[model samples]
Target: MSASVDIRSVSKSFGDVHALDGVSLAIAPGETLALLGHNGAGKTTLFRILLGFIEPNSGEALIDGLKAGCRQARRLISYLPENVAFPKTLTGREVVAFYAQLKGAAASEANAALEQVGLGEAASRRCGTYSKGMRQRLGLAQAIVGNPRILLLDEPTSGLDPLSRNDFYQLIAGLAEQGTSVLLSSHGLSELEARASRVAILRQGHLVADGPLAMLQRDARLPIRIRVKTKPADAETLHREFGGRRINGASVEVTCEPDEKMAILAALHQRPGAIADIEVIPPSLDEVYRHYSRANPDKEARS
Candidate 1:
């Protein structure tokens, strides 16, 4: 499928500093692509280029074949920055309605959008009195005003409580189901782990890794840990059979390659009570980051 959002060999430089270096990636329709990286890793800079706030020094940023910043692209792209500052005195409805007018959408649709973000009851309340999560929802309402095909959210769940965060992501999932391509840059690894269909990890200004989470994990080649609980009397046999270490009175831990997991489990099942309970630990987002960074330390030093 053709990409809904595309950045082709894009690069941006400021004097002696490079914010983006030959970066290229795409977001397919209905896919959520998480941008992962440390501070100064070019995620925000890429977002700015994609949103058409700034131009890249080379190559292209395209939204559904329209050049970035073109009139048509404006109608198809919506952005929510990390800091969603707005006029403190305006009611939430007023804030959304103002953006609706800017997007050439009907002001009457403002309440509908606010309701979609769970702001229906607080629609008439002034922004200054709204809590952080409420303000975030108000900002979200503004972004979805014109029914854009692409959404760019930067740290969107910031300041939200756990319940509010769940609500916010549900809203994002609904948008994706409607074929909206989402590029979300966030520091919340576990949240992204649950929601992102794919991820891109940036180191300094370079794009080091990009693909489905499972694919990246496989490429990282980290061990899969399996901990098995067995009859205390059989612990020694289990450890020797699996080349594992005894962790406690009845528990043994073994490490295996991804492809070896099922085979190892099948071997353990041959003897009764050989394993009472087991847990498989897969590579986490945090480990993936460490794996890639360690492999790319030279790139960081050069940059």
Candidate 2:
């Protein structure tokens, strides 16, 4: 069965410091949800609570209708922390085997896990000798070994190379296709924009925005940036026609509703060789986060 995460009115505090405040969200099975927020925005704290590494001061974190730390929930979930420390003395293979045993994976699964992460030949080398990327790969291997239904990843591609990062995303996509849910918390907004089916934005421990990528963009009141290339003389006319303002001799910029994007394109297309190219740029998650922070300076400042 597919897994789901239900976070209900979760709140956590450290003395006078509030980490999460009345936050609630749900992540459906097989969907890749990106958690976007700045440092100390309580993304890590929420992640920890969901993984049962910490208890929320109030509210519940449940997986597949079970409490966060319940046996069944633990069995169905795997977590890859941002900073993973393995015993320096143990070889990579040994480390994998150790975790495999913890997950009750077959002994023979260790080698395959190592190979899947492109660490087959280096499996015998001590973790101390492994590079950061290699260590990250090992952590990913551990997360995947158990075939858990829900994967919680924090900065999963931290040290991976470009190719490895692409491969890692592909792997995550494959897992989602196979009914495995993934919750990813990352600062890599561009990458998350391309990978996530939905994005949940947190500001000062509160979920300021939650929905599909397109929906969030619309709900955030973010302007749609349109750039058009046109002849110097036609630029002004085109801008006036499209209700945009001319930025330069041949470039025009406009902030339009997301729904009007196609109409804007159609307007540009009607320009009869007047328009050379058109681009629609949505607000990046980083930009959206900044907007929220600016609007709630006191809350974000505390974070």
lDDT of 2 at 197: 88
What is the Cα-based TM-score of model 1? 0.86
Q: In candidate 1, what are the lDDT values of residues 17-107, reduced to their tens digit?
A: 8988998998999999988877788889998998788999999999998998888898888999989689999999999999999989999
Error of 2 at 211 (Å): 1.7
lDDT of 2 by residue, 142-227 (tens): 88886889999988987888889888888899899999999998774665636788887777787776777776555567778998
Clash counts for all predictions:
0, 0
Off by over 4 Å in 1: 233-250, 270-275, 297-303
**What TM-score does model 2 achieve against the real structure?**
0.81
lDDT minimum window of 10 residues, candidate 2: 294-303
Model 2 regions lying over 4 Å from their true place:
1-3, 230-250, 259-280, 288-303
